[model samples]
Target: MTLTFDGTVLVPVADPDDGERTAAALAPLLTDRSTAVLVNVVEKAGGAPDKASVEQREEYAEEIFERARGPLEATDAAVETEIRYGTDVVDEIFAEARDRDVDAVVFTAREGSRFAELLTGSVARRLVKEAAVPVVALPHGDD
Candidate 1:
C-alpha cells in the first residue's frame, strides 16, 4: 500500500559525517508530533559501481540508517527508508519528498551549504522555490 501519513516528514541527510547529530537535533523538534522518514541520497554520479562496491556501499548506508533511526523510534515512532540516486542534491531531495508523499522536509546543512546560502540568500533556494511541501533548513554549526 502507498503510505499515507498523518505526520510524516522528510529529512535529507547529505553528510555521512553529521547524519547522527542531524537526526538527534530533529528528534525533539518532532518527538511529540510526528514520525520521520529518513532518506539518504546515494547520489547517482552516472558512473556504474561493480557489484561488490555496490554491496559495500549499501551495507555502510544500512549501518547509518540504524544509527539515525533511533531517536525517531523512541516515541513509538516509525520511519520509511529510501535510497535514491540523483545528480543534484537538492533535486534528489525534493524528488524523494514528492515520491514519499511527505508533508514537510527538514534538511541539515554543514558550514559549506550554509555559507552558500549566506552568499546567495536562500538556505536551499531550489526547495524554497519549488518543493511540494514546506521546507525547513537546519544549519549545523562548524566545529
Candidate 2:
C-alpha cells in the first residue's frame, strides 16, 4: 500500500514566511478528513529589553497563525491554532504534538547565523532527531 499522511498534523511555525511556506507544502497532504494545528511558540527569556510580554507574544502568534491559515482556506482540512510560551521550544513543540496525538510534525528549515543557532539551537534539527511521530521539514527554498 502507498503510504500517506491521513491524520492530524502539527505544524510549528517560527515566522510568517515560514508559516506560509509550510502551509503551502502541506496542502497536498491535507484532506477533508485531516486536521492541522498551526502553532507558534514564543521563546521565554529573562530580563531582556526586546522581550515581549506573554500577551503580546500571543497576539503575534495569532497573526502568524492567520498568515499560515490563508493557504489552507481552500482545503477541507480542519485547522486549529495555538500559542505556547516556553524556554525550551523543542520540548514544548513535542509536548503539544504528543498531547494532540498528531500523526506528523511539519516545519521548514532556514539558514541561520552560527551564533543564533548556538543560542537557540535548531528546532528543525531537534524535532527530526527526537520526535516520536514523523517529522517533515520542507526543503529551504523560495517555494
Candidate 3:
C-alpha cells in the first residue's frame, strides 16, 4: 500500500545519527500540512538501577531532536519533539503514537547484526507487528 504523510506522524529516534537518517528519509514524503512529532524513548530500568540519569537522557534526547529537526524543518512539514520514559522501548513508542493520535509511526530501521537483534528483540520488528496505527519503515538515506 502507498504511504502518505498527511496527518500527524510519530517518529521514534534512537540517537543523533538515527534522528538525522530517519528525518532525511522522511523529509521527501512530508508536505506543508504534515506534522512530524519526533520522539525519543528513554528506557527505564523499572525496579532496577538505571544505566543513566534521567537528566542525562533528557539532554541526549534534546541532541537527537536537534539533529532530526534540520532535515524535517527544511521540508514544509511542522516539527515537534517529545521525550518519553518507559521500561520497554517499543511499548513507549506505541503509547506515544496512540496518545498523540498519530496517523502513523515513521522511522528508519537501525543497522545491527541479526544475532544482536534476536538477543535484544528488535524494536523495528515489534513495531511493525504490534502497532495500532500504521507503521512506516523508511529506507535510510545511506541505504
Best by lDDT: 3
Q: Each model's TM-score?
A: 0.71, 0.87, 0.96
Worst-scoring 10-residue span by lDDT in model 3: 1-10
Where does model 2 exceed 4 Å of error?
Answer: 1-4, 46-50, 113-119, 140-143
RMSD (CA, angstroms), candidate 3: 1.3
- For model 3, residues 1-143, the per-residue Cα lDDT tens digits are 65569889999999999999999999989888999999999999999999999899999999999999988878889899999999999999999998999999999999999999989999999999998899989987876
lDDT of each: 0.68, 0.83, 0.92
Of 1 and 2, the candidate ahead on lDDT is 2
**Tens-digit lDDT string for candidate 1 (38-85):** 777675656665334656667767877877776556665566677766
Runs in model 1 with CA error above 4 Å? 1-6, 31-33, 47-52, 113-125, 139-143
Residue 37's lDDT within candidate 1 is 77
In model 1, residue pairs whose N, Cα or C atoms come closer than 3 Å (at least 3 residues apart or on different chains), thus clashing, are none
